[model samples]
Target: MLGPLAAGAVFFPGLFLVSKGALRVLLGWSEGDAVLVSTRLVSSLQAVMASSAGWIISSSCRDVMEDRHWLTEAYVLFATPYFAYDVFAMFLCHWHKQQVKGHEEAGPNGGAVRAALSGFLRREVLMVLHHVFMVAFCFPASLLWRRGKGDYFQGVLFLAELSTPSVCLGKVLIQYQKQNSVLHKVNGVFMLLSFFSCRVLLFPYLYYAYSRYASIPLLRVPLVAPWQCNLGAALLWPLQLYWFTLICRGALRQSGRRQKPPGS
Candidate 1:
């Protein structure tokens, strides 16, 4: 556990610095842009690692409830530090953007730090809460709460990250003012589909998987399952629904623009 934690501690920041430097030198991106892109690049890499681990664990577990995969615990520990790193990375990105926008020019350095922090927290409270819960609640629950059962479910949960790369790509495209490009449009479609299928539909699929295994009806599985399992799913699904609605709205706006007559 300590080993993976130490490795992640070094790896994420190292990769971020390397990525930031490369983007600055090779692409001539501004500090703010490089910070933002590097953070997203790190996120995409983590998503791939988590999703691959999920796939491997999920595929190997024949018994959904009883089967155990060694990678489940290993990968979770390795990736745990990423949540903390990401929060700091996000703040750095936000701070650089504030500088780029000249918000810091109006205030002393100390004041700018406070203002940037406050603005970042306000803008990102939901996401920050999500990360906090993962580190505070989900980490122990994943490793300790289950008493060594249900690795399959955890693997499936990790698989929810499958949408992240597309989401990252879409953000980068928009940041670069290429939202009208074909790549952005194609990526938007992919993001919507992946987010919906992997995230929004995931909880239901978990219930269905268990119901089939237990020989119970789909709706009844929730009642029959452990309270903790039901509670976790209940807490998580609503967030996915909310995010999905936002994604849908974005897709609709993009579609509306695409259909606008030339020259408006």
Candidate 2:
């Protein structure tokens, strides 16, 4: 656990700085674009790395408690704290971004910071909710709820994050005025398909694996989960569904069928 985490702790920050510099140096992106793109790149890379590592570790473990794999435990430990930080940082960034935008709308005297603080969640409710769930439900599941009981299962759930990069890229494409590029079209397709596969389709597998391996029946698995855990798991579908709706809406932007509004 410490190994992957120490690696992530080191890797995430290093990558963020490197990617930000590369974007500015190689592509000459504007400050806003560079920050946005670099952040997305860091998120995508981390999700991919986490998911891949979880799978590889699980494959090697065969039995988490029985194998007594410190590796899986370390991974979960790493992820729990990292995600809590991610949730906090993500909310702050969104808030600040919205605040700055508000500041712009109000002109030089608009008091955007005050405006943003007063109506913070007006634009970031969903993102805020998602991160809150991460800190509340997912963190506990990974660390305390099941504790050592289902570390492997907790890792499996992490794979659902694999689609997030595509989602971020889709937004980045639109933000950077690449709406007409073939890359945008390709990213849109990936955003839709990957979100469905990881967030929608594979949901059942997440539970099914838990049931099959844990010897807990499908109907009874929820009984074992902390009530909050079940809520967290149940919420995943609807939240992703909501984002999927947004993805569909964004896809329409390419076709000139609709224009996206702010805070979407």
Candidate 3:
């Protein structure tokens, strides 16, 4: 498993590199901007693959996903490295953008490209925190998974990322200024549906599953146990809810404008 994870870590940057080149040549996107979109597209595709497999294997368990410690361990073992890769990749992109920003200011197009990349990075503050938490906690837990207490609980948390593909696609479409395209419209609709299903509507059920299957009831579970793993899990709900609202508003506002047509 670690072998596959190591391979994945090695290949993640390669995926970013290939995708960035394709976007730049195919779409004439600036290098920094192309990499920004390519990175999300690649990450989103990986999320779908991993989460889809998780959901399927989880479905076969005698009970809910939270009851499958092995499955949880399997996913975390595979996913944590990619999460680490993401943190490093984002940091590298940031540093590269900063180093070139002053030189690139000579051209207006270059400045806009840099600004677009900066805007995307700024919007990822919460996502950066989310990644940091996973790397700091989930990665280590999965490594020592055999001795861990909350294995099943963590499996369920990873499933919450199922909507990420749509979210990524929606952002990429926006970056390309494809607001009025039919594909963009369709992707927006899916983004709203997936966001609600995975991030918003499914959360209460996740909590219920935790309460039902946990060794101790969720409320009774001590936050300090497992060295505050429970605390990290408990706090993610507010972040999900906040991001879900943002998704909904953006989707709805765009859909409305899409219907209005130009010069109405």
Candidate 4:
């Protein structure tokens, strides 16, 4: 609930600002750009708001099912598909990024050949490990949530969530620490926070929902303490907003750096 609210406050406003800013930057238009563009932005915001509301309503309904004895059925019908889609999208995006990089490096025919050869290997080998790790972390938490035995399993889930951010942060810290660009450091910090928010907030809620409501042996206990869940969700939006800002800033800085006259 609070998660959705936080997302609304942080992301919705930030999205509006970014889109408006981008339009201004691209078109060199002032506040009096196009009436239609403004209208469309508002419309898009409304759509996002509607979607968030829908999630809240659906989550509430799932909670109700947990209060009853139907959590497992409800979860399977609703949550499982969403999780599947998320995982699939993650892997697909990863694969796409690799392919794009390969194409850029190899150029035209060589790039195409490399991408064709590497794509399946990347998906089946590299991305499969990520999927396996996510499941390994999540499944035990589901068991704990189902059995109402909230102890070490919860800790384990938390650790698993932390693992990804820690790895990512470690890489940046080790490899890019000496890069004195303020933008790079800022981007790294936000990236770390984004990962932290996902681990500390998003993944936990997901696990809670899955364990208590979504799967075959629904635990039906509150996955996390209510206050914690709400707070975590509330924090997610700001983190995402910052993350987006950092990415855009980094891109701008990188572009500027690239365009600078050498030895000038």
Best by TM-score: 1
Candidate 3 lowest-lDDT run of ten: 221-230
Candidate 2 segments exceeding 4 Å error: 1-18, 21-28, 61-68, 81-111, 117-120, 214-217, 224-228, 256-264
Q: Which candidate, 1 or 3, has the higher lDDT? A: 1
TM-score, one value per model: 0.94, 0.75, 0.73, 0.30
Candidate 3 residue 216 C-alpha distance from true site, Å:
9.4
Candidate 2 global TM-score? 0.75
Local accuracy by lDDT, each model: 0.89, 0.67, 0.68, 0.43
| Residue runs of model 1 more than 4 Å from their true location after superposition | 103-108, 262-264
The best-first sequence of candidates by lDDT reads 1, 3, 2, 4
Global fold similarity of model 3 (TM-score): 0.73
Find the 10 residues in a row with the least total lDDT in model 2: 104-113
User: Which pairs clash inside model 3?
Assistant: none
Candidate 3 global CA lDDT score: 0.68
Estimate the Cα RMSD of every predicted model relative to the unseen true structure. Answer: 1.8, 5.1, 5.0, 13.9
Query: In model 4, how large is the Cα lDDT of residue 217?
Result: 43
Error of 2 at 235 (Å): 3.1
Q: Clashes in each model (backbone N, CA, C under 3 Å)?
A: 0, 2, 0, 3
Number of the top lDDT candidate: 1
lDDT of 3 by residue, 1-264 (tens): 676667677677788888888888988977778767777877887787677666665565655433444556565666666777787667555644654665644234666657756765686778788888878865766556436454444555557678888777776677668877898888878877777777676546655665676566655544424545456546666887898788778877876886887899
Error of 1 at 174 (Å): 0.4
